[model samples]
Target: MAEGKMLEEKLFSKHLNEEMEVIIYLPKQYSPLYKYPLFIIQDGKDYIRFGKLPKLVDELTGSAQIQKSIFAFLPYKTVEDRRKKYHPDGEQNEAYIRFLAHELVPFLENLIPSFQMAGSRFLMGDSLGASVSLKACLKYPYTFGNAVLHSPFVNDDLMELVKQANPGMLKIFHIIGDQETEVETTNHTIDNFLAPNEALHNLIQEKGFESEFHLFEGGHRWTYWQPFLKPSLKYMLPAHTFDLESMES
Candidate 1:
């Protein structure tokens, strides 16, 4: 049960005018000598616990296949708080975006001066959390260069934003389930995740983004997402020159 070490930090954000909790998982061999990529996960605790992220990171980095990146999770106070901060139309949506770009980034940079440039930063989330990550990256394209979205709760606004964004500036890894036709949203409403995800995939293709979109077998839950985690990491950020034949062997 090898895993990365988890550390917690509390930051008072002026943009949102509130305090937030951030959990960071450092790799087993974290050192100040080399810069590492930063992976920021929304719905932070879920990914750390349910996602089996630290173990996955330990395995992937141990295999010498993926980058030894830093994982940061940002959890909300409650379901209501998550809906407020993660939803596109939530009241704190704008401020939350500012918090990620203006506050969180700088804090991490100062806290661990070993992080690479802004391009090494990535944002990831599931469901509504995925939407927030995509929106935040879209809002600050220059700040966060990569996003990994898992069955995001999409709407007309997000589609339009993706349509208008420059594909060259951002890289995306998107996955949705074939049976995600009745996914539940932050508002406790049911919507078809597959259709919107397919539409988004098409738009990303038309936009010519360096992206990967997959239609997995299961619904919008950790069951499907956890398995794809390794593939997602390999696709988005390969640390070493991977050998396909060796992997197959």
Candidate 2:
């Protein structure tokens, strides 16, 4: 198995007025001489722990299935902080979005050798995390080119944002469980994530964005979401083709 180096870092955000913890993963063969794509995930700790992201990335990249890229996981300080940042109606939602685009992007780009272009950046999250990722991408289309949403918590406000966005600027990968009709939320309420996700899918299609939507046979949990990660990563960041014979010469 290819072993990637993981680093822990901190960034003080002016917009959120807090120090954010970031977990970064460098590919097994990572080199500063080559520029790489950046994959930023909201709810970063969960993805690292439950999603087994680094393992999957190592397997895919080692097998030449997907491109070797840098992954940045942004974890929240607390549950309340997560709600405040990821939820559209939450107090720090706007600031959090700005932090991702304006503060976080530049910080990472300067800290690491990367492609430094919109197309080389991707945003991903699950549930409310997915909500925030999509919002940041929509708000700053030129900063992120792709988004991977796994059963995002969508609402009227978010749908409206999608309606007004330029579809040509982004590519989206969305998946929602057919059984997510009554998922419990952080606010201690049962909500239907399926319908709103379906509506969002329709809106994205209607808006003519380059997207792929799927209704999987599962619920609002990582058990289902984890299986899709490989396919999604492969689709978004395919392995770079090289001519071995020419290089040998």
Candidate 3:
């Protein structure tokens, strides 16, 4: 098994007014001998614990399926305050993106000897967290190179972000289940979910990006995302495929 570390309250910078509790996975043969790619996830606790994302990574890493890299689930400010921080028009959106780009990136670079800016780093999330994954990639193409969005809230704001996408140095994997209709939070239909995702796929195609869109036969919940987590990790973490091969050596 590759070494996995769960750390809390690692201050990116006190001045940024940011702190993250990270779940980090270092590959089996992790060493200071090479530069590493970065994968960042939002809804940090869900991805690491509830979603079993780490287990999926461990399986792939042991099998030598991708390149070795640093996996980070950035802790939220607080559970009660997530809505204010994650929503598109929320007050903390700018600060959150800034924290990921400016603070978190540098923090990881200082810790991982091999960290690259191009074709390396990734961001992922479920629900509102997924919205910000795409938003962050669109906002900072040079900073985050890949994104995985699962059952994201694809509303007018998401369309706005897609319209703003640069497509350079960024690849995206977008997946929504067939059953995303709800009065879960709002009076939205399944079409409401698929429509925006389709719009995004078309936009990405128009922009000439490397991306994929998948619609599964399920609803908006952790049950569906948990199963898809492995594929999500593998598709985005191409380097991990190679690393897993080497780990077996």
Candidate 4:
């Protein structure tokens, strides 16, 4: 199996007035000579551990199915912290979004001079994490052009933002499950995740964004979300120019 290293780093965010951890995945064959695309995944530890993302990225890149890129995983300190940062109306929402766009992006760029192209930046997350990813891309479309959302929590406010979004500025890959009828919220409330996701899908289609929306057969869990991860990555960040035959040799 192809292998990679996860380097853990800490960034003190002035916006949130706290220190946050960032886990970065550098592929085994990574070279400083080549410019790499950046994929920022929210819920850092869960994605690296539960989602088995490093292994998946190694396989995809090893097989030349997608580009060999840099993955930066961002984890919240706690469930309460995650709720505060990821939710649209949370007290720290605006600051967290700003931190991501202004603080985190520049940190990565300066850390690796080879990390090039602002357009190659992509943000991904699940549930409320996904909601925050969409919200960030919508607000700072120039910084994050591509986004992957898995069963995002949507509301009237999010829908309003989506309606006003300039589809030309962003490309999105979104998916939700048919079985997410009554998913539990952070506040212990039951929410029909499917209805809002379906509505969001229709809105994206109507707005003519460069996007793909899929309805799967599972619920809002990592097990269901992990299987689609490769496909979603390929869709949003295609490696059409990769020479598969040469790489396999």
The prediction achieving the highest lDDT against the true structure is 2
Ranking by TM-score: 2, 4, 1, 3
Which runs in model 4 stand beyond 4 Å of their true positions?
114-116, 241-249
Q: Relative to the unseen true structure, what is the C-alpha lDDT of residue 229 in candidate 2, on a scale of 0 to 100?
A: 93
TM-score of every model versus the real structure = 0.93, 0.95, 0.86, 0.94
Please list the C-alpha lDDT of all candidates, in the order they appear.
0.86, 0.90, 0.72, 0.86
Off by over 4 Å in 1: 241-249
Better of 1 and 2 by TM-score: 2
lDDT tens string, model 4, 1-249?
339877888889999899988988887776665667788889988887888889998888878788877899998888998999999988899999999998999998777533345468899999999999999998998889888999999989999999999989989999999999999999899999999999999999999999988899999898899988989978976787443234421
Winner by TM-score: 2
lDDT tens digits, residues 169-231, model 1? 889999999999997776778888899889999999999999998899999899889888888
Candidate 2 RMSD computed on C-alpha atoms after optimal superposition onto the true structure? 2.9
For candidate 4, give the lDDT: 0.86
List RMSD in Å for every model shown. 4.7, 2.9, 3.7, 3.2
